[model samples]
Target chain A: MILAVCLNPALDVTYAVTALRPGTSVRVRSVQRRAGGKGVNVASVLHQQGVAAIVTGPAGGSAGTDLTAGLDSAGIGHRFTPIAGATRQTVAVVDADDATVLLEPGPVLTNAEWTAFTTSFADLAHEADVVTMSGSLPGGVPGDAYGRLIGLAHAAGTRVILDCDGSALIEALHDAPDVVKINEHEAASTTGIETDSAEGVFAAAEELHALGAKEIVITRGAHGVAARTGQGRFASTPAGTVDGNPTGAGDAFTAGLAAAMAAGLDWPARLRRASAWAAAAVAIPTAGAIDPGVATDHETRTIVQELPA
Target chain B: MILAVCLNPALDVTYAVTALRPGTSVRVRSVQRRAGGKGVNVASVLHQQGVAAIVTGPAGGSAGTDLTAGLDSAGIGHRFTPIAGATRQTVAVVDADDATVLLEPGPVLTNAEWTAFTTSFADLAHEADVVTMSGSLPGGVPGDAYGRLIGLAHAAGTRVILDCDGSALIEALHDAPDVVKINEHEAASTTGIETDSAEGVFAAAEELHALGAKEIVITRGAHGVAARTGQGRFASTPAGTVDGNPTGAGDAFTAGLAAAMAAGLDWPARLRRASAWAAAAVAIPTAGAIDPGVATDHETRTIVQELPA
Candidate 1:
């Protein structure tokens, strides 16, 4: 079984309006809500691809109730540790030429709540063969929460794929998960290097590896993705720019990578599948919504090249 | 005791930010939420003044749960009829010199839910001496809901004060509640007349009275207020403008008007107290948070002049 950890989950609310006036009232034309957070989105993509994954985390209050019901309706298994604070909600106001996001701070996780989750995480990690830890840590959580979880997963003989950024990623790299996934911007931010070109991206990946990351994948928009590991390095290049919503592409890539690892696919085939899945994801409108048929069509067409290490 | 009916209650969520840039993410600097709707605000005002009032309406879903908890914390008595749909939420993004409100279309009230509320309304109306019905009706509720409620109140020998506008007010005017409170703009719109001057406001009030309203109170903002009834006509001019948040001034007026009616005060005294309370409400920062001390200071000092019949 695959375990996905969403430390901070949210009810993603989308409001459609004709125009967003600054000082006046706007009657929302329509509203759509779904359960969201990086790990949850990844798990959603995995479920759509007929993969088995459980979304686990700390959820609380009324918003958490909505998230729990959302996960259930989507047919994704969840074992969230309940806390006293309310979960957060992310609002996106979509207008003709604008998609403005208003992000709320997630509920603070108390030390007791954090301790309780660590116990749950240990047990779940023990049962799972692969674990993916992603998403932000709610306020009051330690910066090295994912690192601690990675350590637990390693102790249980389970492989972990981590997708986080900045200080959280830096801290988690010390524990060294099996795979680390990030975009070019996060790679630059985390490694303190300019990743504007291929060489810069490769250098950043090597830096991450030296920081204890076993395998590194850096996704660059349009340029596709690059991976560097102890074995060698490989990069993927899509046919061309596929125009669609790029909202959940990263999560889809994470889902693809984790599923590929579980399926025992080699690094080259894994990169190819992850790139194809990401392209398929961007071709859709809704976030975390993927068409397996489209993914299959793109999978055979994407090109994966082995680069000189 | 007063019964306040809020047909469409909401969780008022305020997000403070430095600036709202479209097509980007805005991190909320702070967030404040409260139970809000016209009648609920009126009930809150009454509760703050140590008056006995019960706020009753149709509430449901998670947002309703928050509203119920918020009212409980404020020491307001309430018994909201439960429904299946989620309550609405109003988001206000506060930027410098701007408060952009985004109003969510509230849940559709099923026919069964409307029937359920009417049953609760009858019980609450029978026990109360006065009933105040205000605010918008959620989608699917009849436009004349307040008219039906007014008939129920009148059947129970309870005086009714209605604070509504547009088609709802047009339909409810047929019930001839004791008082119809509206701002000058709403009065002009409802009466289909231009109320830009004192004569226009008086004419509009007479038109509403002719349509079966017993007494009419038209709040003219800084120009103070004007009133017309069978007894006579009176106008109140406050000492001066009291600068503060003017969001809930009308609700404070409704509460004061009802309280004065229960005290058996005449029209002039009722108008005076209502105006004073509205000023007090404006002197505070939040809606429905009137300082009783300020209200008392303005009550005896407000100028009430007898006008032509």
Candidate 2:
């Protein structure tokens, strides 16, 4: 079973408007809302793949309740710790051609709330084979929050898949998570290395490894994923470009990696699987959803290439 | 006691972003949410003025829970009927220079929910001196919903002030609400007569009177309000331009009208009081909030003119 941790979940609201015009009142044609966060998307993908996964994090207020209810409606298992402040919300105003998103700063948790969530995470991690923590930490949480969770997951004998960027990624690398999943932009910005080429990606992965990650997975959208594992370095790219919404493609990649690791797949196989899942995610409109037919077709079509050590 | 009926209340969410750029993601600097709708705004203004006003309407789902919570936190009285569908939400994305509002179509009420709300409204109106029904009716509600409510309020010996637009306004006029508060745009659009001039405004008011409105009050931004009452034709304009958000100015006007009627004020006095409140509302940044200092200053400065009947 996988334990997916989403510390900064939101009630993702999508408003379909005829057109997005600045400084004007627009009547929305329809509204769609659901629980969303990177980790939540990972759990949803895992659940859709028939994998046993439970969502664990802090949820509070009306948005929190709505988030949990959304999970329930989706048949995704969640055991979120209760907090005092309301969860954050993200609004996406989608017109015919593009979407504009407004993201709110999530709730600030007290020390007590953080402690309670960590306690809950510890318990959930103990019962899981793999734990995947994703997304940004909410306000008032310790900067090395993912690092602390990595320690707890390791203590519970659970392999941790850390998917985040910036300082959190930098801070958690010291905890030596089993797998670190990041997109190319985050990898480039974090290590100050251009990841447009294979050598640059490997160089960035080497830096991350030196900092303490056991395995590094850097995803380049459309170009595919490059990874450095204990076995060797490898890259996987999709056969063709799939088009739709790329919002949760990375989360789907993390879900695939976690699933492959739980099944004890090799590094090359995990890379291929993760790339296929990401392709499937992009073929769907909403986050936390994948096209199963697309996933199956991509699984066979995605090519895994070996790189020199 | 005034019963403020908000048939289509919303959980108004405001996001303050650095700037609004279409097709781009913007991080919101702050988020502010509260119970909102025209009637909710009316009730809030009435409460701020120390008037006894209770908000009554059908509220459901998490947004509904949040809406009611907001009302409670503001110390406003409410007796909302519970329903199965969730209330709608309105998002206002404010940047440095302007605001862009996205209005969602509110929830659809079942026949049972409508019956339940009407029952509650009937009971509440029985004990109230005035009933102010404001805003657009939600889907599935009868077009003549306000007309029926007017009949109920009248039967209970309560003066009714109806504030709505389009067909809902046109249909309700048959019931002869004691006061019909409408803005210049709504009035012009409903009557197909431009309300840019005093003559045009009076002509529109005359048309509304012919359609069965006992007293027609037309509010023109900056220029102030014009009315056709049983006593005579009158117009009240604020002494100076009150530059701020005009979003809820009309609701504040409705509140002022309701409060004055509850106090047994005549046409001219009610127009003056409502104009002062509307001016005060324009001074505040948020809807459902009025500046007491602004209200006091405007009350003395607002000039009422007795138009030749």
Candidate 3:
């Protein structure tokens, strides 16, 4: 079983309006709400793919209660530690023309609360073969939060996939997580390299590798992903165009990668699996969901090429 | 004591951002949340003024739970009936230049739920000197909900102040509540008359009176209010320019009118009190709040003049 940790979970609210006008009142035609965070999304995709996964994180207040309830209704397992502050919320106002998002900074965590969560997470990490930590850290949390978690997972003889950005990603690289998954934009920001070209992408991955990442995958939307590891450098290119929603594609990719790694697949096979799942996710309307048939079709057609040493 | 009915209470969430750019993710700098609805605002103002009032309404789900908790924290009294559907939430995204609002349609009430609330409201109305019903009705409620509530208040020998618009206001007029308060825009939409001028305002009020309204108070932002009642046609112009947030000015007006009526103040005095309270509310940053010192200043200097019959 995989244990997924989301440091900052949100009650994601999406409002569909016919038209959104600034400085005026708009009636929402419909509303959709769900438990959302990168780790939660990864768990959802894994569950849908018939993999056993449990989510753990800090949840509090009404939004936290509602998030837990939503997870329960979706039949996803979660063991969240409670805190005093309310969980954050993300509101997406979608119109026919475009979508606008308003994001609230998540609740602050006390030192005692973070320590307690880490203790519980260590216990869960011990029981799982692989652990996944995703998303941004809430306010007041230690900057080395993911680094500590990675160390705990390694001590438990379990592998970990770390997916985060900015300072958190920078700080966690010293811990040498099994795999690090980041989109091209995050890769660019973290390494200060323009990852718009293959050479630039590989250079950023090499920088993260030198910083102690065992394996690094940088995903370029629609273009595919390039990775670097001790074995060699590999690139996976998707076969056909698949389009719907790109919101949770990264989570879907992480889920596939984690599942393949747990099944002891090689790096090439893992890339194919992850790319297929991501493409399938992009073919659906909502995040953290994929069409199994589409994934199967893309898996066989996905091309993996080896780069020169 | 007065009883205020808020059939559709909301968890009002306001987000402050440096700028709101559509189709992009905006980081909210700060967030403010409160229990809000028209009648709830009335009760809040009354409580601040030291006037005894109790709030009643239907509340459900997480938003409902938070709404009541907020009210409790504010030291307000309430007895809300429970329902199955979750309460609604309204989001206001404010930038330096302007504010955009997204309004959710409130929860749908079952016929049984409406009956249960009406029964509870009747008991509360019977014990109070006056009752005030404010704002729009939730979906699945009877169109004549305000009309029925007004009739019940009359049967219990309790005066009622109603603030609603469109079909609800038009249908409720036949019940002849002691007072009907509406903004100028609502007045125009309800009577199909352009109420931009004093003459048009009075003409719209006369039409409403013909439909069985005993007293009509039409508020024209910053300009003051015009009224028509059995005592005579009277208008109250605010003393000076007062401005801040006008979101809850109407509710403040309703609270002042209810307070004056409960104290047996004459029509002219009631108009002056309502106008002063509204002006005070506009001088503050949030809704359901007022500057008492500003109110006293406006009240003494307000101009009351009789209009031709």
Q: Compared with the true structure, what per-residue lDDT tens digits does model 2 show for residues B1-309?
A: 999999999999898889999999899998888999889999999999999999999899998999999999999999999988889888889999989999888889999989998988989999999999998888888989999999999999888999998999999999998888898999999999999998999999999999999998999887888989989988887868788988788899899888889998988888888888888998998888888888888877888989886
Error of 3 at A260 (Å): 1.6
iRMSD of all candidate structures: 0.9, 0.8, 0.8
Which residue segments of model 1 deviate by more than 4 Å?
A: none
Model 3, A1-309: lDDT tens digits are: 999999999999999999888899999988888999989999999999999999999999999999999999999989999999999999999999989999998999999999999999989998897898998999988899999999999999999999998999999988999899999999999889999999999999999989889999889877888989767999888978896888899999999999988998988899999999999999888887898998999889999898999
lDDT score at residue A151, model 3, on the 0-100 scale: 95
- Model 1 TM-score (2 dp): 0.96
Q: Rank by lDDT, highest first.
A: 3, 2, 1
Clashing pairs in 1: none
Full-model lDDT for every candidate: 0.90, 0.91, 0.91
**Each predicted complex: what DockQ?**
0.73, 0.80, 0.73
As a whole number from 0 to 100, the lDDT of residue A7 in candidate 1 is 95
Candidate 2 lDDT, A1-309, residue by residue in tens: 999999999899899999998889999998888999998999999999999999989999898999999999999999999999989888889999889999888899999999999998999888998999999989989999999999999999999999998999999988999989988889999999998887898899999999999999998887787889888888887868998988899999999989999999988788877888888999998899999988888888888888887
Q: How does model 2 score by TM-score?
A: 0.93
**What tier of docking accuracy does candidate 2 attain?**
medium
TM-scores of the first chain across all predictions? 0.97, 0.97, 0.97
Number of clashing pairs per prediction, in order: 0, 0, 0
Residue-wise C-alpha lDDT for candidate 1, range B133-209, written one tens digit per residue: 88877888898888999999999899999999888988998888889999999999888989999999999998999
